[model samples]
Each structure stands twice: as structure tokens, then as C-alpha cells.
Target chain A: MLDANKTIQLSHGGGGKEMDQLIKSLFFKAFDNPILRAEEDAAKLQLSGPVAFTTDSFTVSPLFFAGGNIGKLAIAGTVNDLAMMGAQPEYLSCSFIIEEGFSIAELKIIVESMAEELQQSGARIVCGDTKVVPRGCADGLFINTTGIGRIIMPNISTQNLSTDDVIIVSRDIGRHGAAILMAREGLELESDLTSDCASLWPMVEQLIAANIPIHAMRDATRGGLAAVLNEWAKASNVGINLIEKAIPIADEVKGLCELFGFEAHDLANEGTFVIALPREAADGAVEILQRYGHCEKACIIGNVVETHLGKVVLTTPWGSHRYLDLPQGELLPRIC
Target chain B: MLDANKTIQLSHGGGGKEMDQLIKSLFFKAFDNPILRAEEDAAKLQLSGPVAFTTDSFTVSPLFFAGGNIGKLAIAGTVNDLAMMGAQPEYLSCSFIIEEGFSIAELKIIVESMAEELQQSGARIVCGDTKVVPRGCADGLFINTTGIGRIIMPNISTQNLSTDDVIIVSRDIGRHGAAILMAREGLELESDLTSDCASLWPMVEQLIAANIPIHAMRDATRGGLAAVLNEWAKASNVGINLIEKAIPIADEVKGLCELFGFEAHDLANEGTFVIALPREAADGAVEILQRYGHCEKACIIGNVVETHLGKVVLTTPWGSHRYLDLPQGELLPRIC
Candidate 1:
């Protein structure tokens, strides 16, 4: 058993007895599964058919946040990428690069969060590697999760969007970015603004089951909704006309954005997603999204148009329109 | 075109125009492939039958070494893991967590090295992610690679060893560890002592093609030869009797081991591997290994025995015998 006060040491990643103990007592126990317990160089998996493979490295600073930590984000980020591809999140490979002298107890909490998040998508972490660097060689900890999942609903792609497709927002935007900012600044906003860092596969699975004929679906991470819309516009060679008021944004997130001189649309969100489907299926998809507790704010925010191809045009409440370019400069570093 | 004098900014990983430009100008161009060109959230793959899934994160200090750089090690390490599972190396997912202000020119060189190494195994890097942290938050750069491949030769496992199974080493050991140590300590040995870092899939592929009934095979990496043998002995519940004199070790590595009070067997090797198979197939495996110029020194080093189950016993040159225990403490940090 690891001592509560003990911290991670270089020996823990030395590929020796200490590493063995750390793996068996901590990692193995938390992520116990038949495939992982097989103890092979690589995890043997029985995968067939077409699969979606993706990877993400979580370097979110402040490691811990209001709604999630790096561990939960690591699992959700990669799983969400697979889910956005219309794939059934199945397996994940986790690798950790830890700084020497990190708390073992804190590490346990982070690991347990990963195990808890895996249940959201039924994605098992089958194989993993750990490396510990010298003190100051790294921040607290960084996690990389690569996922592979079977594609259940095919042909959902950015290029599949047509002029008649309707754009929808799953929920409020910018919560994740706001939450991390608040945490870093040690601000007590007196409002319950937590990161929108939840596993999106559950909600996506519902959409697939309803057969809404999804064209393109992407989680609004990193560069957020603006980036995704711009990429989609260019990939599909269609214009996206978004209604500024129709897009959902929490008052708290908007307030934080104002204080920080940032745009809510450009702020990151871990759980929010954008979807494009035919106008006929838009209402059904929105209805399905509304059934979920977290996605209650889901609504149609825009529509695809043939004019101004490869550009995202946004109409303000005052009736003026402008091109929403791909985000420029760094809004926030290490924001998941 | 990226400015050669520019350094990587936080915006390069901010999921914005800068990130897109960096990826397109460097990563996409270097690892050019149709699957990667699609630029979906995940790479779409058509896989069947049992597959191997593995992940490794490389944080080796110095970044550059005598024979290979971190990029080469990152690719070869994960690909080698799949290859050791009797899997044909295929798709790889690379995620880079880079420190802010790192040189763009150096990043290009590293990315090119990764592309060069991929040619050896014919594996394509299909999907990836990039995250940049603030300066002082991380070392220069860290790479995490996750790979998946089809298991062409199945049932190669650690538990498959049995009595009379001959143990064959692919080549001399401890070069990687020694090379890193020399580079770190600024030791200029009179002789050429470069890291034995190379891809092992091509060699593994030949053995599989030759119909060698390989019971088990593992690359002697982090914990080195002693770690691999000890793990095999315990996993297979069989004793291993190694002839110390027969195990090949380069003179420079031996001299360094003596100077540092470290054992050659306990040092790491990037490309070297140990194989366990029936005695009848030992010479055939050695002959095949010797066909490769780098593996010319391949030879049988030991055999499985019933006498010290779950333990490895080494017979010294003068006939003294001792238990070779699993490596303990921190032999060297970040040697990978």
C-alpha cells in the first residue's frame, strides 16, 4: 500500500520494482479488467469492422477544477473525439508523464476520476505507460489518452454538410474555459460556474439511436465553436449564418468573458458540441438533446447557406452581420 | 511558410489558425497520407481480427542523442510494442505536449525524424493532437504515441514460456543507457558508442514469415535485459538459467557499467529484444536475426528450466551462481 503522505519518485517510473508496485497497487487496481490484467506488452483486443482512432494530450493547468480534473478531462476529451466521429466509444490507451515529487494521494484521486469517467462511455483503458521526469522537468502531471472505437453511424463528416443543413448547439458554451480561468485566478464568483467537462458519448449515443441523419458533429474544444464552424464551412464549402442571440451562453460564462475581454464563442467548452443535419431533422435532434439534463439549452443556432462559401457569417442582434473567422492568437493556454 | 527563426507560441496549440498552420506546414506535410489528409476528429480505419493496442509517452532528456532523437524513439518504441505482440505495425496516433517558446526549426527536425522512422515499419501516423503549455511548465517537448495493429501471429504472450525454451537476444544490450549517460556526462569515449535505437518490426516480421514458433518476445527497454528476463520468469512460472558469459555486452558499455557501479543487464536498450522459443528453433531465429547488420551479434543467452520457478539464476564465468533479481531503485531517470 502506498503511504498517504508519500510522493511520486523517479524510481516509480524506472521500470523496476518501484514502478511495478506503483502500477499494481494503483493503476491496476483502479482500471482492473480482464484484457488489461493479461500483462502483455500490448493489450490484445478483438476489434472488427471500421474503427475511429483519435488521440489527445491533457495539459490543463490547475489540474483540478470545479467540475473535473485532468483525469476526467483526459478520458472525456479522447472519448468525445471518437463519439463525434459517430463511433461507439470502446477502448482507450492511457499514458502518463508525471513530475517527480507529485503527491501519491493526489494521483490516486485523479486516477479514480478516470475510472469513474470511463463508465460514462463504457470505454475501457486497455493499455498504458508511465514515465516520471525529474522535479521541475514537468508540471504536476500530464495525461495522454488515445482511443479506438467502432463506427456505428458512418458518413457523418465535415464535408458532408450541405447548404440546406441546419446548425445546432448542444448546450451553453464557454463554461470549461471560464471555469479554468476562475480556478487559476482563485476567484470566488459567487456563481456556480463549473467546467462543462462531461463525457459526450452518452448524449451522442442517444442521437445515433434516434437516427437523425447527422452530417457533422464536433465537440467545441480548444478553439471552441468558432473554430469548429470555420473548419466546417471550409470543408463543406458552404457558408454558416449563425444568429448571435440564438446561440446559448450561460450568464456567468458571458460575464467572465466580458471581464477577461474574450468572446464566449471563442472560449473552450469540454462538453458542448455543434451539429449539422438536414433542416428536416434539426427539430428532432434538438428535441432529443433537450431530453438530457445537461443539454437542456440545446437549440438551432444557424443554418448552412450557399452564399459566401467557406465563411462563417454571424448576424448580431442589431441585424448587422460579419464573418466569424477562425480564432487567432491564444485565448488561453493549457485550457484542456 | 513557417518562419525558420520563429519559436512555437502558445497559439500553435490553441486550436486556431496558428495551430492549423503549424500542423499543415509541418506535421501534415511530413506524415502525408490520405487518411491523415482527411483531417477528421479521428482517423477512420478498417480493421479486422484480433488487434494489438499500445501507448507510450517519451520524455527522454537531451532530446537529441547520438543515433536517434526523441521523435525516432517515440515512433520506434510504440511500434516495437505492437510488433512484439506479433502484430503487423499499422496506424499510429501521435500527441505532442510542447513547451512554449521551443524552436520551430528544432520541432521540424524532430517531426522529420519521426517520419523517417515510420518508413522502417510502414506504419502511418493517422491521427494526432497538440497541446502547448507555458514556459517553465514542461521540458522542451514530450511526445505520446499510441498504436494499433492487426495481430498476424497471435498467442505470443509472457505466460507462454516452458522448460527447454531457448532464450535468444537480438543484439548487444545497454547501449542506449550508456549512450544517454555519455551524452549527459559529456564523456567522449575513444570508441564509437551510439544508441542501438532502431525499429524492430522488420526483424520481427521476418521471423514470423519464417514460421518460427515464437512463444514469447519482448524488447529490452526501460528496465533492460534483467527486467525482461525476470518478468518472463515470473509470468511463465518457470525458472530461467542464463549463461552470463554468453550474453553479449559491448566493451564500452561494460566499462561504463564498472565506472558507475551499474550492471549492463540493468541498463536500457532501445532496439534490442529477447526471445523465448523451443530449443529446436533457436539457431534458426539467430540466423535470421544475424541477416540484419545491426543484429549480427544475435545469440542464445539462456534457457528455461524447472529448477528455480519464478526466478532467474545467472551462472558467472567462473561458475558462481546467483539470483538475478528485478532491478531496484532508480537506475537512471528519463533514459528512454
Candidate 2:
């Protein structure tokens, strides 16, 4: 029997005695549920009607960082995708790729974090798979989470935005990207700046409950605000005009962006999200968003326009207009 | 812009122009479907009632093998899990973790294989995600597939076996584990031994249609027959008595197992499966299984017993009895 207190070994994933022990002691205990305990090859779920399904692989370097680790990110990333589609986050499948000689203690820590994060959205980890590769075959760990949820609000899409729709950002942008850059570069900042990685299902559920006529909702992750705006413009075939000054940015994020020569809008935000809705519902949505602890900075940022179809134009505070092109090149890899 | 002819770069996973181009030109063209074309963060599916959800991560080395590649393995592994639960494989979420600088041509080949494999089970790759890590951060590629299906036969579990139940092997076993070992060791044998890595859903669907009164069904993957039988014994609190001479094993697999000092029962088999059915239905079940191409060698191998609770007793040809224990230690890592 391999001691999980030590490093993980190939036997722990070999589907034998050690593997069974590992799963029973670690996984089953952490993600205990009647369905999982049934020991069927698959988890039996009772879901109906239109359901949302999404998958995300988190290979973030420095597995642990400010605010969250890869495990939390894996859960939040997939759950947020479902929530963004107006789905009530429900069941999730977690798969881990662990390198041999990795610390089992660290694995437990990560798994605990994942279990804790699931409570935020009331989603359960129903099924999971674990694979261990030889050392050097992979980095410490990579997690893949696939989520399934019931669609509470239908027809929310990138192509749904139309003229006169107002855009509102959930919070300040670029924190996640900036935090990762700081961690990789080993920089010490005076401020308490951390990645904005968090589960967004609670807020999304509230929005759905409020009966807001949300046209579309998306979390600005990789390629950041710029990427989301660009994709929306092209998908909906509408021009988006952004008041640059209205977009929220923390001072530390701005400073980091200035130092790295990266646009704040092009930096990812894990927890932050953007919403498009009719102008009549803009204030009510923003008012509802302000109640969340992280959404205090939520405000209107942009709106749909007729000019420059399939384009995004940003007006600077100094009254200069510039086209916000889709982020190009490798700005920051593994920002998630 | 990153050229598809060259190696994959960071931009290819950056959620930018390159990523969009790769998804459109490669993935979209390969797995074309209406649900996937909706372009939402999550795929919308209309699933109702009892659904089977399973997940698997394929980290097999030498991405391509004699019988299948990681792509095919990813699809078949998850699909088989759902099938084992007597479910109709429906939706799959594919997430890839690729090393930067990996060949784009190879990725396309893998993706095409995945698309082709999906046809066997009529499962669609509805939602997916791609992440590229820095070089050396991961092996060539790791695929995580999570599947969702409607359960055609419910309550099939490991704990469902009763005394008059008979055990049956779907076909000859151990080919998959042997083939992988030979490939990794660079062995050249005259015999054409290929992996038995295949989609088992079609045959499983037949069994369900035929109404074999299945108590349990599981693919003998890692830890092979020994693991599955032991799991069944312990879960059901019953004993399993196997006639060693009756279990089928291919010549090449037996040869490889002997040379490696490994037991054929301890070796893995991807396509092969085991079933526990009522004694009266045993011959009918075997007849149905043998009708399939790969299941020509399917036969009755064992039966449930009241003695030796939570154990598997093997009856050799010499009238000798021995315990068939769960595999211990690492037989072969990354054999999936």
C-alpha cells in the first residue's frame, strides 16, 4: 500500500489496490454523495428539458496563487460558463491529471478547495477520473471540469445583442491576468492585489430571478474584455461603442498593465462578467449587481451602435476614438 | 497569425484570432453539428429523466497506437462508461491540454479520429475547450472527455449481483495492455497484436435491446478482469468462482503476459467487458455477445457463490483453487 502522506506514485492511478484506496480515502470522502456512492460506472442524474453543458481545462502555472488555486479555477470556470448561459449550475465532473512524484498533500488541498467552491453554486461533483503520469511527463497538475445545468433563461447568446442595448461590467477588469503575471514574475506589490477568480452562479441566479431581460452574459476570461467585445460585435453583427472612462480598472492593475505594456481590457478577469440588456433595464441590473461584495464597482461601460458593423470603437477620456481590435499574439499564456 | 501547417503556439490557445481560426478550420470542420455551431459558452442539450454522466482522462503515451489513438480512446472510454450503465451515449464534452510546440498536423489527426469514433456511438462533441501549456509543462497531449446519456436501463450497479448470477467475458482479454507495453518497450513480435481499444456501446445497446436481465456490466479496463470481479464481489458482498480454463485469452496476450511476468487477468482490456446475468440467461447472453465481430470469443467464465464472501475463487483445470486478488502495485502506468 502506498502512503498518501508521501508523494503520489503510479500505483495510485493504476486502478488496483492503491488506486482504490486513494479514491475511497480522498475523492469519495471529499465528494460524498448517494449517487457517487452507488459505484456505477456513470453517475445517474435526473435532469430535464434544455440543459447547458460546458467543459474547461485549467493548466495554470503556479498551481496556487493569490485568491485561488487551479482547483477552484477549474470549478468556477466551467460553472461560470453554464451560469453565463442562464443555466442553474448543478452537476460537475472533475478530472485530474497528476504527475508522478507530486505531493499528495497538495492534491488533497486542491481537492478540498474544489469541494468548498462547489458549495457556492450548490453544484455537486458527481463523477471524476484521476490519471497519474510519470514525472516530467506533465507539470504538477491539470484539472478538467465539465458542468451540466438546467437552462433557467433561454436565448441568451452573443448574437442576441441589438441596437440600444446597454452593456454593464460586473466588476473591475484585468485583475486575474495581472495577478498571474505578478506571480510568475515573482513581483511584490504593496497592495493586496489578487486574481478575481470566483464562482459567479449566485449572482447569475439572482439576475435570472430578478427577471432582467438579459440579452447576453459572458465572463471576460482569456483575451479579456477586448476579446469578448470583439466576439460579440462579430457574432451579433453590431458595432459597440465604449466610453473608455466608464470601464472600471483598479489602480494596481493599471500600474501593472502600464509596466507590462498590456492593455487592461486585454487582461483576463475570472470572476468579472459583462451583461447586455435593453436600455430600460440597465439601471435595475446595475443596482442589483451592486449588492454583491465583488460587484461594487459594477457600472455601465458600453452600448450597441449602428456605425462600424462588426467593430468596437472606444472613446478615450480625452475625446479620442480608437478601434479596440481583438487581442492578438501571446499577451499572457495560462492566465486562467 | 499562427499558421496551421506549423507547430501549435501560445496564440493558438489564447482565445484570439489564432484560436478562433483553429477552432473554425479544424474542430468545426471535423465535428460539424448544429448545437456546436450555436457558438455559446455552453452547449444546450435537451436531456430528461435519468441520465448517465461519466468522465475519463486519457494520458496514454505514444498518442497513436496500433488500434487507436488518444482521440479514439477518449471518446470510447467515456462512451463505454455510459454504456456500462445501460445508457444511450448522447453528448460529450472534449477538453484538451496540449503542450506548446506540439504539431498541429498531429492534433488534426487526433481530432479527426475523435470525430470518427463518435459515429460508433452516435455521440456528439457538443462543447469543448483547448488549453496549451508551455513546452515541457505537459506531454504531447491529454484529453478529458465527459459524457452525458439517457439511461435506457436504470439501476444497473456493482451491488446488484445475486447467487444464481453467472459471469461472462465479452471477448478475449489483455490485448490492450500487452500492445501498449510492446509499443513502449520497442518490441517486435511476429504476431500482429493490436490494442482492443474500441467503442463498446453498440454491443451494449444490443444487450439492452435483447433484455438479458443484466445485473451488472463493466468494461475490464485498468486492473483488468481481476479488478472488476473483485469490485463486484466486495460491493455485492457475494463470492465469485471463476473457471480459469474457461476464460478466454488470445495467444499474443498470453505470450506477452508470460514474458512480462504479469497475469493475463491483471492486464487491461479496453473493448472487452464482463457481465453478471441470471444463470438461465447466461447462454443466451453469450450467444448474443459472440455475434459481434470483436466478441467472437465471448463465453461463460464464472458464477456467483454464497461462500468466500467478498472474494474471487479461481478453479484451475487441475481441480486446484486459489484466490484471485485485486491487482497490487503499479502494473503499467498510463495504460489507458
Candidate 3:
């Protein structure tokens, strides 16, 4: 017996049998392809070379928020994920779950935004799909982007980051987070803070070109410096020692964070990077990044250590210490 | 001064400048990877040897439609595309566009369905992104999946299609299209004619192992025979002469099509395939494909020819003649 649920409910997209039926009877019926035909767990392509792959999802509210909207966020988010692997972003596939009755005009805007962003990142949106649910089934707009990029500098190592590695941030922190907070909470902030949203390739290309002996690089996004530091610690099986005084923060953002009882260290900043490099090449890499106008506010944020596995401590300006942990609850939902 | 209307639009997805802003400000910021960092159009990767890349989109309406949902469709569509290329579908990247108020349960279901289908196809869901739009901004769900596969068959070739190529079908046509018509138009055809929605790789694998001199293969999906034949015709730079009587048709589907004034040939069919092979290997290919439970009814319907430059003509049972052109107007909206 066929039942008609007039509007979409969360259960429909739950990846269950009902969803499977929808695909088998409807979607799979329309477009047929081999990759989809295999029904594999992960698409496995026999590649003759080493490559990089990345994926990201956007659950941000205010489909169009301050700094950057969901459209821009969707493409950049995945592209950057692949880039973090030191892989040159290449082809992208876009998928959309459009809630019924969504304004086509606005979708056009977002699609246009996505197209332009893809161009800047130098990626082609070769293939994609679109589905529509009835009204009240989802938030205004939610987008997911998955990208494939070819690894260019295979020798630029990341699987090995050890002690004596210096952690460098491309610029001052708190811009993106502060912008989001201001926009969401309607708080009056002193600075004209905009998200530092830009392609990192310009800066990364220079670093790779300069032959910097870097261990790893990461974008300081949600959960901010602390989250990124923890990941590095785990990925490289090492420890981190951060110097609070050396970390860069714009005075405007710093003042606002303090007023709001927020920690500056935990703020999210887009288009900024934290790179772990050998002590010897740290200075030179920072210098090279600065020339590209990406890291004008570059600074030595911290250094790696041999002791204290999987732990991070931040020394405060008042000469106090605080244990750093991944942000538990989302401070801002869809900041990126 | 923060003119929100100056905000981004959807045209960005079309590939342009505003799209650049979206990528820079949102996507790259979230996922900072090396390959994505390169930001190149149609990413060029060093040959990993041989590769398979395919893309497909989901624009199904009634997001909770019958048979399979968008999530499962996303996975199956791309997998099938890759398989048609003779590639073992491996990696997949999905992009989602969700509308406001879409139940989280539905999203979860779709994701879960994707996971299940991927497992069935022997692929995995590696990376994905999501975006949300305002209420009434979009349908409940839309998905785009791009799959990459490994070309294990080095000698397998698309260029091998030659004159005297015998055609074989994986299954009967019109089930998918007929089911959709019944569901969409509220037509009651008294029969349990469900869509033939099952992965074809198992059968194709048998065919490949049998070592048939397969020239070309395509999933007869949207535009049905019209779409695939047109594509093959243009690609092979040849004509296809089809025997209308030889094409299999279920009585129920035929009756339903007559009632709706729909051409069975142009109706979308999900679980069917058109394969071309040398005359010598036709029987072998058909025999192997028929070994599968669903494909036991597989039969020969047409052949390839050198003349007629991209034209498909059919010889009816009554010896009448008709030229088949790709359907111009929208035949079925959101059928898949």
C-alpha cells in the first residue's frame, strides 16, 4: 500500500528503507550511471597517481548570513578540507536537499554564489543532483559539497609531525567568529569585523613553492585554535605547547570577546591557517606567506613538544594557565 | 553598510565570480585541503594509471516519493554511471540542498539510506556537505553525487564500438516510467508492476568475466531509449537501426502508456541497460547477462551501423518507418 506523507519529515532522509525505496523507484530510475550502479560503500577509482578527497556539510541557519552565506560556505568548506591535505582541489560534486516551496530566486543566488566560488577555487562542478521535499520539512536551505583533488606535492609530508615543530598562524584570530556572534546575537561590537573568508591557495601555493619544511597545516575554524591543536596532536602522535603571548588577535575582536565573556583563544576565524613547521624553516615560511598578503598578521602561535601526549595548555596574559579542550557545545551553529 | 540584498544568490553554482566569494568565504574556510587549495577547473591529477569519473544530480520532487528516496538515488545514480564506464565505483562525494523546516528525521533517513546503498554497491560514503535555505525557498530535498571509480579493465574501451555491433538489454523497459506515471498522475493500472530497481554490476561483472567483446553500454534512464541512443549515436558518430518489435514491453506498461498517450520508448526506466557488442560476441554477452535473476528476459533489440549520422530509425512490426529524436519538452518532471 502506498502512503502519501504530504510534507517531508526527518525520517525520510534518515538513510533507511523508506529512503531506499524512494531512490530505487524514482531517482535511480531517472539517471543511470556505473558509479551509482555499483552501490559500493565508497566510490573506488583505480587511480594511477596519489590523490586527495574531502567532504563537508552545511547546516548553517540564515541560509544567507553575514560574512558568507551557506552557498559560499558549502563549496569553500569542502575545497579547503581537500586543500588541507596539500592536495590541489580539482573536481567537485554538489548535492542539494531543497525544501519544498523554497524561493527559486534565492536558490539562484546561492547557486550563482557557488559557481563563482568554484571558479576562484579552480574547481569544476562536473556533476550534481537536486531533490525537493514538501514544506516544513527542513530549514530554509542546507547544502553539502564533496570534492576530489589530485595530490600535487606528494613529498610534502604530513603523516610525520614531531617535537620542535613550530606552530604558525597566518593572521589574527576572532574575525569570523566575532562576525557571526555579532550577527546572530545582535550585539554591538566596536570593530567592523568581517570574516577572513578567502581562498588559502594563494598563500599555500607560496608556502609549497618556497619549499617550506612544514609538518602540517590546518584551517582554524570551529572550536578554534584548541580544536585544531588537538587534531594535530592526535594525527602526528605528538604534544603541543602554545604561547598565549605570541598568538595574534585583533584588538577589536579581543575587546569584544572579553566583554562577552568569551575566550579569545576559542574564537573561529575563516581564511586563516595554523601550520606546523620545523623550527628552522618557520621564520622563512612566515615571511613567504606575508608576501602574498594572506598572512600580514602572521605570528608564531606555539611550538610542539616531546612531553604530555594529547594535551594542550594555554598560558594567559595574567601569567595563569588553562587547559584547552575541544569546544563541547556549538557556540555558533553554521559559523563556517 | 551591510545591504543584505547585495547578499549572494544561487547563480554562483553556475560557475562565475560570486561563486568565488562563496567558496572563499565559506567552503575553503571549513575544509582547508591541499588539492582543493589548488582551485583548478576540472582538476587535473597525475595519472594514477587509469581512472573513472562520473557525475549525476537528483531533482526528484515529492521528496518522499515511492520506491526509493533521494538519498538512495544519489548513491545508486552515480554508481551506475561509473559502472557503465566499466569502472569499479569507489569514492563518492555528495552535495545536499535542504530546505527550512525539513524534518531532521528525514535527513537522517536519507543519509542512512545512502550508507546502506553504498554498502550494497561496495562503495562508501566518504565526504559530504549540506546547505539550508529559507522556508518555501526550495523543495524538501535535492542531492548531487559525483563518483570516481578505478578502471580495473585496462583493455576495456569505449572506442571499440564498431559496425555490426549487436545490442543487448539488461532488463525490460517502461517499468520505472510506468510506475512514475501511475504515482504522479494517479492512474490505476491493475498490476503489481513495480520498478526494476536493482544494481546491475553483478550481471555486468558476469558479462565482463565472460570476456565478451563489449563495445559500449548505457543505462536507459531519462529520455529512455531516446536519450541513450542519441548519446551513443553522437559519440560513436554512427546510426542505430532498431527493430521496434524486438524491444520487449510488458503488457501492463504498454496498456498504461496507451492510456496516458506516452511513448513506451521514451519513458524512463531505472533497472535496464543497453549494451553493444561485436556480432560474434552478442550471444555470449546476452547469455551471461541473463544468468542474473532479473535479466533472464534480456534480449537483442537493435544493431549499430556506419551511416545515418546520429539518427535512430525504427522498423515497426507492420513494416512502418519512424525516426526517433530525443524528446524535446519535459516528459516527466521529478520522475526520478
Task: Using DockQ, give the best candidate's number.
Answer: 2
Ranking by DockQ: 2, 1, 3
Task: Give lDDT tens digits, candidate 2, residues B1-336.
Answer: 335589988888888778888888888889999999887899999988999999999999888877888999999999999999999999998888889999988998899999999999999999889898989999999999999989998968899999989999999989899888888888735568998998998998888888879998999999899999999999999999999999999898888888889999999888999999899998888888889989999999999999999999999999999999988888888987
- The complex in candidate 2 yields a DockQ of 0.90
Q: Please state what fraction of the native interface contacts candidate 2 reproduces.
A: 0.97
DockQ scores for all predicted structures: 0.89, 0.90, 0.15
Fnat of all models, as shown = 0.97, 0.97, 0.30
Task: Please give, for residues A16-99, the per-residue lDDT of candidate 3 as tens digits.
Answer: 344455445433433234554444223334455667766555666566655676777777777776677677776665566666
Q: A1-336 in candidate 2: lDDT tens per residue? A: 335589988887887667778888888888898877776789999988999999999999889878899998988998899999999999998888899999989998998999899999989999988899999999999999999999999979999999999999999999999888888888735568889999999998888899999998999999899989998999999999999999999999999989989999999889999999999998989989999989999999999998899999999999999999988788988876
Error of 3 at B293 (Å): 1.2
Q: CA shift at B113, candidate 1, in angstroms? A: 1.5
The residue-by-residue lDDT of candidate 1 on A1-336, one tens digit each, is 777599999999988778888999999999999999987889999988999999999999899999999999999999999999999999999999999999999999999999999999999999999999999989999999999999999889989999889999999999999999999998845779999999999989999999889999999998889999998999889999999999999999898888989899889999999999999999999999999999999999999999999999999999999988877788788898
Candidate 2 Cα misplacement greater than 4 A, ranges: A1-5, B1-5
Docking class of 2: high
